[model samples]
Target: MLAQTNLPQVAHGAPYLSVVVPIYNEEESIPHLYTRLQEALDELAKPYEVLAIDDGSRDQSFHLLRELAQQDGRWRVVRFRRNFGQTAGFAAGFARARGEWVVTIDADLQNDPRDIRMLLAKAEEGFDVVSGWRAKRQDPFLNRRLPSQLANGLISWATGVRLHDYGCSLKVYRAAVVKQIELYGELHRFIPAIASWQGVEVAELPVNHEARKYGTSKYGIGRTTRVVLDLITVRFLLSYSTRPMQVFGAVGLLFSGLGGALLAYLAYIRLFMGSPLADRPLLLLAVLLVVLGVQLLGMGLLGELVTRVYYEGRQRPIYVVREELNIE
Candidate 1:
């Protein structure tokens, strides 16, 4: 499948901050993104490196990043074999990061690079993870803003993170904290929630958000369904990961109890009141529930076995390392 790789070391020394920008087909925005990002990082007056990940862009994104990396040792580029999604890109960046703090931002220029400082400021308050909140989002009301609002609310309620902008890519985290959380699928949006599981301090701050000036948004309303599905996964990992049987067994018992009560009532009706049972729909319902309950209990047992295998099995890491650039 997909593997991670880095380039030869560029000898920029250890960076105080590592900015990871995942670029996908954003050819026109590269120049502007690089210039503004460098300007912002320069102003911070700290050792920093920009880890630009080209997520199998079909455009000149990789070429642009390569040229920039050659020109500036502080600019490191990682090219993926194919588009493995944003989560994979983040995982690669995190694996190669050698900074005390890591920052993530989109490559579309919508998230101002200058906002990186805002996140870092909040992060300095001893918060392990500092997330950006787009208090006043600049997007269409129907397609972009509405769906995002609903998704953010649902994710907060489900994960108990209570952030207004879970979709914002501008965020800051201590390198150590993020390294502890594994990335997979579309779990990048749930980084805060995942980090919360380690009992880390998480905070949110309002940041500047601008409308897109380059290509169209990669995501749309269709992604909402995927986000909901991933949220279920996150909830399971957070609550029932250590004890899968509790959730499954509890629900299974409820169904089994209801089914047993129904069957008992039907038995009483048939024996004591001389009522016909074969023609009644309640009998079928009871039988169906009982079968379904047993299947659920069996699935619960299977889930426990899988969980053990996941934790105690081969002990493989999530992302594969191909190579690293400018990293010692």
Candidate 2:
């Protein structure tokens, strides 16, 4: 778990809300971001805490965060030793959060803090996850916006959870829903899809997006490859994470069956038709497919063994219980 930087626990019990802001290099926007966020949070008149995660910023961002933590008890800072990306920052914040509901926002000021109310309103209607839709995004089309559109579409199609803007930082989740997610890589944006495995209801709301005013964008085309690879991972976790043999075993069977059929036909031809298979390419193809299929089957068996051993050794429950009946 990532340690908190410079604040003690302010309350005895959990707060009503925990807002997580992952900061990188936004030194210039810290003052205005803090003021506006404070105003918005205070307007709700609810017990809340802010988790400001500085992802090892080389700028004066952590210095500004430390100052804010000193001024207000609600503001808490978690400073990483080095840059580990936004996903790690969010993971660290979630671990330290003690609120009924959690909201994630960016420190770059592109995400509107005032829109927090809208996400809460949507969540009040019994949604486990409420995502912000930046319908009118304010970024360059070629570099930023275009790749985002393609990635969002691909992810939605792959995960069976559709949303207009997965790139939006403004999202709300129930504490229980988020606590179950095991964050790694750049999977922070895929929270809605990841939580869907537990049968969560998801909703989307149109939110405000502002152009960058202070610092440069952290995202680039280089991250597209990572996002695509994680998309494949999310799909696998959704479909066959619990039962690994289903996928690999099915493919392996198909390949092995086809190869066996070809080999049987060649053997019969060689015996009855007196055909020489010494120079034939079909024999080589059949032998290669059989070997590949056996290797795939072996991998599937290993995965199954690992999964079983992991669950048994940890003594962990395989299911999540949202509530219990009187019978219990």
Best by lDDT: 1
lDDT of 2 by residue, 1-328 (tens): 1124444435445689999888888888888898888789878878888888888789998887777776667777877777778998888778778888999999888999999988998897899999999999999999889999999999999999999899898999999999988788889999999999889999999999999898888989899999999999889989988788888888888889888999999999999999999999999999988887888898889889987986668443222222111100
In lDDT terms, how accurate is model 2?
0.85
Off by over 4 Å in 2: 1-12, 309-328
Which stretches of model 1 miss by more than 4 angstroms? 1-9, 314-328
TM-score of each: 0.91, 0.91
Query: Which tens-of-lDDT digit does each residue in 239-317 have in candidate 1?
Result: 9987888888888888888899999999999999999998999999998888888888988999999999877886454
Looking at model 2, report the run of 10 residues with the lowest lDDT sum.
Answer: 319-328
Error of 2 at 299 (Å): 1.1
Candidate 2 similarity to native, TM-score? 0.91
lDDT of 2 at 133: 93
- For each candidate in turn, give its C-alpha RMSD to the true structure in angstroms: 4.4, 6.9
lDDT of 2 at 145: 93
Q: Report lDDT per candidate.
A: 0.86, 0.85
